[model samples]
Target: MELNQIYNNAREKMKGYCKVCPFCDGKACRGEVPGMGGAGTGSAFQANIEAWQRYKLEMRTIHQVQNPSTELELFGVKLTTPIIKAPVTGSSYNMGGSLSEEEYADIVVEGSKEFGTIAMTGDGADPTMYNSGLEAIKQADGFGIAIIKPRSQKEIIKRIKEAEKVGALAVGVDIDGAGLITMALKGQPVGPKSKEEIEELVNSTDLPFILKGIMTLDEARIAAEAGVDAIVVSNHGGRVLDSTPGTADVLAEIVSEVGGRIKILVDGGIRSGVDVLKALALGANGVLVARPLIIGVFGGEKEGFKMILEKMTTELKKAMILTGCESLGAVKGNILRKLND
Candidate 1:
């Protein structure tokens, strides 16, 4: 079947939590609401809505061009596009569902194979998850990347060693889960840590490390200064800290502050290819999508995931064409046209 047909099929069949959050529950479950009685809540969710709207406008302007190429390189890995799958936790655990490690890994490997880019795995340093990842790594045909999250410095060291042993291409540290956890939410807990502690974790491994859940330029600069390989300017997809600024809002500042010293990646409420384009134009090396892939995964496993990747790359190529960008490098900060009141 054609890619769009597959996407629509998946979209049609997608139910339960697999439904689009922005469309279904975005109105009532809205964050940034003036009187929402929750911590880290309010407005951040609204930013996602705004981002999606802007994305639609931009994609409409660019969709009809021929040969919309979506090729880019990330962390020395040549990719057909800068778009990537974001890492999501509690998929079966925190989400009241169940997907075996092999099943999850297969979708990633297969999708990456189909898309000609690397897929990002979100399993942290848990022994069971790592073992599952190892099995998938063995079956994979050089079409993906793994970013294992460790709870502690020791776990980080062990996970990095394992990833190295598996010959994984890149490494990412989820500082978003670094230190403090509160039982105030229904989902997984976010661990907050100090720069010193995080620096120690980064220095623990020789692999290219990306500090995920970075929402501030100051933290991004710290990651760069510490010789980390990358920084995922993210808010844990708005799952961790509720009211954190959208990655797009602060992406340019982080990109400018980091000063090309290291690769920069951004994630959080990224649902489409145009979203990826906006991120790239605002100074991100690439963008990550997690929940959308989860929806795809729940809908049709590898096929569903592959459809999502195809959709984003297609739309991203459309954006590139209209923006007059022939290559990833051509889609620079100047492509961004901010709306001013």
Candidate 2:
């Protein structure tokens, strides 16, 4: 089916929760908690899109680079593209219950593997949400990453052990989930961690341990000092707080402070392969595509998801070629021209 058809199908299935807007921006669904909108004023969500749009690319066609490589290696796993499907849950309530948690995780894990990249599964207030992702990872022979919520220390450690058992490539905690009221509503409390607490958690996992949702250079440094294998510079898709700066707005500063020390992945309002190029130029090792994949999976299942990834990868390759980047390593901040510059 065409992408538009898939989107229509998803909109029909998801109904009130998500309108499945064409742009997937926060405009139509602002303040939509149970659906795909941002939190509070939705400014944070909008900021993500605006921040990326603020920068323009400088094209250079006078190059002999015939082929541009989009290959990326993360945590010892080789991926065709430096893009990973972000860990997302809430298929039940937030997504209108059209797709079960397990079904969604299965599509993402299998689809990502088929596309030569890995998917990150998410944790939710419900225990089954995480378990389903683990099962999917097991089915994928542990080619997935399971991101846990910032639960109690005991709970986080318990999930880490489970992730190891499933042979997950890496595991992490989206510390930004600490502000999610749904966790408390479900009786699973979550909160920010002290540096000591973060260090202890990192030490508990033998596998690569990532810390997601870091938006500030200070926190990025703390994560690096705490020995996290990587960090996802995210604003929790603007779902956790209002008026927070977009991930792109603060990514350069964070990367400057902790770039070589930690693998930096970014997400939030990344809708296209061109956006992915912008992210790489700004020093992100990888980018996460969230809402678009949600549309893909909900609309067309595994094939739908794969189609979106492949399209984005193709677009990224084209962007690289036009910008004289022969490989992902060659993409630099110079490729982007700020308005003032």
Candidate 3:
């Protein structure tokens, strides 16, 4: 199915929850948390979009770069593109029940595998969220990454064992969800982890461990020092806090501090292939796409999501060619022109 068809279908399914705006920016759904916009004020969500707008690409056609390879080997997995599906949950409340918890999990994991990449499944306030993610990963034959919530060390380690049993490619904790009162109300206490706590978790897993929700240089360094395999430079899609800077705004700073020490991934307002290119230039080993993919599935199921992935990958290839990038590695900060410039 085409993107427009998928969106048109999703727009109807997600009617009141999401407007399914032409651009999926935060302006249309301000202060929407359980329903998909930013948590409060919606500034953080809008910031992610505005930050991308601040940088313009520099066109340079006179070069020997026709087919820039977007391929990358992330944590031993050969990927056709650097795009991974972000872990998302709560279709019932957050998405107007468009898809069942199990359905959303299955589509993302299976779709990413079909597209030659991994999907990161999410843990949420709902008890079935993590379980659904694990089941989906199992069905994919260990092709996906299962992201757990920042529950107690004992709890997280227990889930880690379960993820290992399912043969998941990797595992992670969405520490960004620490502030969700929903989790606490459900009798599952989650909070910030101390460096020592983080170190303990990293040491507990042989599976490549990731710590998502890092937005600052200090936390990036801490994740590196704590021995995380990767750190997702995200503000949890602006769902956790308000007035925070966009992922694009602070990515360069964090990369400058620990660019080579750790694998850096990012997600937030990343709506197109150009945004993906900008992420690589700033120093992301890879990136994630959430809202678009969610809406894709809502609109057209498996094909809908796959179409978005293919379209963005094609766009990234075109972007690489226009900027004279011979490959993913050739994309650098120099290809981007700042608004101030």
Candidate 4:
């Protein structure tokens, strides 16, 4: 099954929750909460796509490179490509109840493994949402990452122990979720963490601990100071806050502040390998794809997901070769042309 076929099937299956627009831009479903659109005016969501579009790639073909490597080792885990499956939850409410939480996790973990990468599973308002993801991770021999919400210290620590039991590759807290109304509505207490609170959680995990939802240089520095192994430069896909800057717009600033101090990953409007190239050039060590993968899982399950990954990897390699980047290491800021520049 092709991506288009998968998309069509997903659209039919996920009608109300997600239109599964041809572009997947925020335009079609703006301000749609408990669904696919961004929060508020959806400007934050639209910003992500627009920011990436503004950056042009500089292509150069005159180089002695027979092959280019898309391979990367993130936090000691070998990956075929730098593309990862971003954590997602709430299949019923947010994704149209087409697939159960467990079913979604299964496709994400298994498909990522097949593609030589890892999937990051998410936590949600309901406890079962997290448990199902943990089960899928265990099934995949812990070839996955579990991202917890920014719950209270006790709750977050408790979940970390669970992730440890499952032997997850890493654990993360999307602090951006602190403002999610869904969590509050469900009576699941969640909020932002203090520096001490963040340090405590990082200290509690032997596994690499990541702090997602970092959109500012200060927060990036704080995560680095808190000793997080990595930070996902994200605006919670514009779901948590309205009118926030696109992650891409602020990624370079964050990286400049804490680049080598911590590994940096990013996700937002990243729909293709070209976008992946742009992210790396802007200083991301790796990148994640959410909406497209949702389509892949819903439409084609594991094979469909695998197909999308392979296609992106191929596109990344092509971008690398044409830009004279022989390895992932060679993909640097110079390869991108800023809109202002």
Candidate 5:
């Protein structure tokens, strides 16, 4: 079955039929969680369906029909598309351990290589998961990035060194996940403290550094000025901040502030080609995806992920054609029509 149909089928399969989406568990649906809504059909598969539908509608323009190339150049690596699978940890938290870190990286590596981009391994520095990433890196021939959610300054440095030793193109420091409100509200421990530790890690690494969880222009500017290779404007899939603005809402601000200085990637609530278009228009260099990867893992594994990539790439190309854009560079700010406008 198609990815979208699978998502719809899953959604229909949910019990209780509450107006509130299970994805948000009532927070995002009611706006109590604020920017929690619009997180891509609640998973990757559904987001692909939504993107496909939007692509059909938006492909009337020359850019959309031509299907503009979604390729991106980050630091020195060239990618086939701007859509990246954001690294998500704690897969065992859901799915009863269906996706071990190694198996997940293997699938991501296969799909990313086939699609011509980098898949980020969601190790989060767990010894078991980190070991899995090492194996997957060798198996996939290192076609992806190793994202480390560090628990300490020393661990952060160690993770970056390991990634570099494995020849990873880059090491993403997921500092944005530091403030998970649910965990905090529950009196559970949160992530590490202070950007100083992160700054130290960046200094420790020779490889290009990507700082995720940047929200405001100040943070973007600061990271750029601090010499980060890329700034990922994200809120950790709304799993961290409770009422933060959607990454899209802040993309322009962050992009405009840091565009010439660093590569700006946006995540959170992006589910379609149109969403990607909006991000590019708002000035993002690329988009990162999370829950969709989960859906792909659940529904079809590696091949399922490859199909998701193809469909999203096709939809992005269609959107580009409709917008009269022939290349990623041509997706300008004028294409986005704000609510106030």
Candidate 6:
């Protein structure tokens, strides 16, 4: 199926929930948190796109690099690309229930596998929300990850054990979701963890531990000291707060503090392969994609999802080759200059 057809179907399916905007920038859906828009005026969400757009790729044609490698490996899981589907849930409430939580999980997990990458499933107030992802990952031979909300430590460890039982590639908590009143309203309270509390969770799990929503150098340092395998430089897609800097703006600072000490993944406003390359240049080990991929899922299911990944991989390689990057290792901040520069 063609790309246009996929979006057309998505627009029809996600009419009330999402407009399936030509560009999934935050403008069209501002303040629509029950849906897909960012928290308040949507400035944070727009900042994500703007942050990436401000960096122009410096072209260098006089290079021997013919093909660029997009290969990424996380916790020993080899991936053909660096795009991991961001953890998203609330199919019934947040997404219009066009697809159930289980259906979405199955498609994303299988789709990620199809693209030779892995996905991260989310947790919420609803038990089934997290369980659906676990079941799908279990069906896929534990090829996906489970991201829990920042609930109590005992509860988190219990969920971690569940992830371990499924032989998951990794387990994590969306510590950014601590401020989510929605979870508390539903009787499951989530809050920020102390450094010691975080360390306990890390020590309790044998599987690779990931701490999502690290936007500061201090937290990145703490996560490193606590011994997490990876830290996602994110702001919960600007859903948890308003008027915050985009993940891209803070990623470099965080990376400078703990780049080699811990694996760094980042999300927000990552709409294309060029965005993926930009994130890597800024020091992210990988990038997480959501809004656009959600369109892919709503429109064409697995094939549509894989098609987006294919386009991103192709665009990334083309961008890398033109930028004199033969591999991900060669991508550096020097290859990018701010538009204002």
**Prediction-by-prediction clash tally:** 10, 0, 0, 0, 13, 0
Quantify all predictions' global Cα lDDT against the true fold. Answer: 0.64, 0.92, 0.90, 0.91, 0.64, 0.90
- Candidate 4 ranges with C-alpha deviation above 4 Å: none
Q: What is the C-alpha RMSD of each candidate to the true structure, in Å?
A: 4.6, 1.0, 1.2, 1.0, 5.5, 1.1
lDDT (tens digit, per residue) of candidate 2 on 1-341? 79888899889988898998878779888898866889988899999999999999999999987799999999987899999999988898788888889999999999999999999999997888999999999999999999999988999999999999999999999999999867877888899999999999999988999999999889999999999999999999999899999898899999999999889999999999999999999999999999888888889998888988988898899999999999999999989987751
Residue-level error in angstroms, candidate 1, position 38: 11
Residues 15-37 of candidate 1 have per-residue lDDT tens digits of 33343444422444443211111
TM-score of predicted model 2? 0.98
Q: TM-score for every candidate vs. truth? A: 0.82, 0.98, 0.98, 0.98, 0.81, 0.98
User: Model 4: how far is 209 from its true place, Å?
Assistant: 0.4
1-341, model 6: which lDDT tens digit per residue?
99999999988888888988888889999998778888899998888889999888999999799977889978887899999999999887677788889999999999998789999999987977999999999999999999999999989999999989998889999899998756876898899999999999999978889999998878998999999999999898888799999888898889899999889999999988899999999999999999888888988989998898888889999999989998888789999988872
Give lDDT tens digits, candidate 3, residues 197-296.
9999998989999999999988988999999999898888888789999999999999999998888999999999999999999989999889988888
Any idea what lDDT model 3 has?
0.90
- Which of 2 and 3 is ahead in lDDT? 2
Return whichever of 1 and 6 wins on lDDT.
6
Itemize residue pairs with steric clashes in candidate 3. none
- Runs in model 5 lying further than 4 Å from the true structure: 4-67, 181-196
Model 3 weakest lDDT span, ten residues long: 179-188
Q: Name the candidate, 2 or 6, with the larger lDDT value.
A: 2
